[model samples]
Target chain A: MHDKLREHIEKIVPLSDDEFSFVCTHFSIKKFKKHQFLIQEGEVAKHAYFVVSGLLKLVYTDDTAKEHIVSFAMEDWWESDYYAYFTQTKATMSLECVENTQVLCLSYEDYKKLCDSLQKMERFFLEKANFGFVGAQRRIISWLTSNAKERYDQLLKQYPALIQRVPKSLLAAYLGVSRETLSRLAP
Target chain B: MHDKLREHIEKIVPLSDDEFSFVCTHFSIKKFKKHQFLIQEGEVAKHAYFVVSGLLKLVYTDDTAKEHIVSFAMEDWWESDYYAYFTQTKATMSLECVENTQVLCLSYEDYKKLCDSLQKMERFFLEKANFGFVGAQRRIISWLTSNAKERYDQLLKQYPALIQRVPKSLLAAYLGVSRETLSRLAP
Candidate 1:
C-alpha cells in the first residue's frame, strides 16, 4: 500500500528509503465498501483520500436534491472536498466509494507537517495541484464550446477506461445530460 | 509593482526584506495597452503574468473562428495559458488586455529558481494552486447545475468588481450565453 504512495510521489521527486518512510508516517490506510461515503455533505472533510484501488466519486447535491458529479477518482487518483479540507469548513460536497476501495488518507495537519519537514513533498504536491488546475480549466473550456456529443467523445477519448468502469446513468449525470441524451450519443 | 506581488505572496506566507528582494529578481515588469495581445494563439506562452493593475481576457477561438472567453483576470489576479506556459507548448488560446495592464512576468526557469531557493515561495505557490483548483471545481459544478441567470448572479455575488469591469459581450462569452441572453439576465 505504501509502495503505491511512494511511486506516486517519486513520479515527481524521488524519495530515499528514509524519506519514503517519513512520508508514509503522514498517511494512514483505510478501506471502504462500495456506496460508503468518505465525505458527507455538511460535515468537515477531515482527510484527502488517495485511492490505492477501486474508485470514488466526488459529488455535489443541488437545492432540488439532484446530484451532480464533480469528478471521479480511481486507482492512483486523489479525491476530497478540498475547499472544506483546506479551509476547515463544513463540506458542500460529498465523496462516495464506487467500489470496494482502499485509500491512503492524509489530514490537513499532517499534510502541512510533511511539507514543512520535507521540501520535496511540497514539490510533489505543487506538481499535482498544477496539473489538477489544468484539468479543471480544460473541462471548463469543453463546457463553454462543445455540444453533448463532442463532450462525450472528448471524455471517451481522454479516459476510455473510466467510461468502461462508470455506469451509463452516472456518466449521464457527469456530462450534465439526460440518460436519453447519453443513449443517443453512445447508442 | 513589486509591492503588489509581495502583498499577494504575504497573504499566504510572509517573507523578509532580503527574501522578497530575491523573489523580485526572478520577475520582470511589462505593460500593455487595452486590445493588446499578451499571448497569441500558436505562440509559446513564455510568461505567467501577475496582474498589478488592469484586466485581461484569456480567449479560445473555436473551429468556426468565434472566440470563447476562457476567463478574466483583473487586478491582483494571475493570467496565462498556464498549460502552454508550464509545458512550453504553443498556446491554443490567446490572452489580451482589457484595460491598460501592468503585469509582473515570471518565466518558467525563474519560477523553478524561486521555488528551489525559497521554501516559503513553494508554499505560497502550493496554496495558490490549491485554491485555483477549488475555484475551478466550483465553476464546473455551476456549469453542471446552474442556468445562465443563476451563473451570472453567482459571478456577480462572488466578483462584483469583475462584473463591473467586464463588458457585457465578454461576460456573455464567459457565461457561454448570447449577448441578448445576458442583457435579459442582467437587465
Candidate 2:
C-alpha cells in the first residue's frame, strides 16, 4: 500500500525512502462501498483522497437541484472539494464513490504538517497543483468554444481511459450536453 | 517594495519578515511599455510575472491566426504561460502589456530555490495554485452550460476588476463571444 502511494508521489517528485515513509505515516487508508458519499455540499472538506482503486464522481447541484457532473476520478487520481479544502468554507460540491473504492486519505492539517517537514513533497504538491490548474483552464476554454461533438471528440482523444470507464450520462453532464447528444456522438 | 511583496505572499501564507526577504531577493523588477510583448509564442517561457502596476493580457492564436484573449491581469495578480513554463515546452500563448506595466519577475529556477529555502512560500504557492485550478474548473463548467449573457454576468460577478481593466474587444475574446454580441449584452 505504501509502495502504491509512493509511486503516485514519484510521478510528481521522486522521494527518498525515508521521506516516503514519513508521508505514509500521515495518510490513512479508507474504503468505501458503491454510492457512498465521501463528501457533501454545505460541509467543510477536511480530507483529500488519492484513489488506489475504483471510481468516484465530483458533482455540484444548482439552486434548482439539477445535478452537474464535474469530473470523475479513477485509479491514481486525486479528488477533493478543493475550494472548501483550501478556503475552509462549506463545500460547494460533493464526492461520491461510483464503485467500491480504496483511497489514501490525507487530512488538510496533516498535509500542511507534512509540507512543513518535507521540501520535496512541498515542491511536488506545488508543481502538481499548477499542472492541475492549467488543465482546468484548458478544459474551460475548450468547453466554451467547442460544440458537443467537438467536446466528445476532444475527451475521447485526451482522456480515452476516463471515457471508457465513465457512464455516458455522466460524461454528458460533464460536457454540458444531453444524454441523447452524447449517445449519438458515441463511437 | 518588500512590504508590498510580503503583503501579496501573506494573502496565501503567513510569512515571517526574514522569509519574505529571502523570497523577495529572488524576484527582479521589470517594466514594459504599452503593447510590448513580455513573452511570445514559440519561445520557452523563462519566468512568471507578478503585476505591480498597469495591466497585462495573455493571448493565444488559433490555427486561423485569430487571437483569443485568455486572461487579463492587474496589480497583485500573477500571469504566465504556465503550460510552457511547467512542461518546458514552447509557449502557446503570448503575454502582452496592455498598459505601461511594472512587474516582479521570478524565473523557474529561482522559484524552485525559494521553495526549497522557505516552506511557507512553498505552501503559499501550492494553495494559490489549487485556488486557481478550482476557479478555472468552475469557469469552464460555467462556459459549457451557460449562454453568452450568463457568461458575461458570471464574469462580472467574479472578476469585476478585471472586466474594468480590459477593453471590450479583448473581454469578448476572453469570454469566447463576438464584440457585437458583447456590446449588445452590455448595459
RMSD of each: 0.7, 1.8
lDDT per residue as tens, model 1, B1-187: 7998999999999899999999999999999999999999999999999999999999999999988999999988898998998899999999999999999999999999999999999999999999999999999999999999999999999999899999999999999999999999999
Cα lDDT tens digits for candidate 1, A1-187: 8898988888999999999999999999999999999999999989999999998999899999999999999999999999999998999999998889999999999998999999999999999999999999999999999999999999999999989999998899899999999999999
Q: For model 1, state the Cα shift of residue A31 in Å.
A: 0.7
Worst 10 residues of 2 chain B by lDDT: B137-146
The native-contact fraction of candidate 1 is: 0.85
In model 1 chain A, the worst 10-residue window by lDDT is A1-10
TM-scores for the candidates: 0.99, 0.94
For DockQ, the strongest prediction is: 1
lDDT of 1 at A84: 98
Considering only N, C-alpha and C atoms within 3 Å, which residue pairs clash in candidate 2?
Answer: none
Q: Kindly report which residue stretches of model 2 are placed more than 4 angstroms away from their true locations once superposed.
A: B14-18
Scored against the true structure, residue B103 in model 1 reaches a CA lDDT of 96
The CA-based lDDT of model 1 is what?
Answer: 0.95
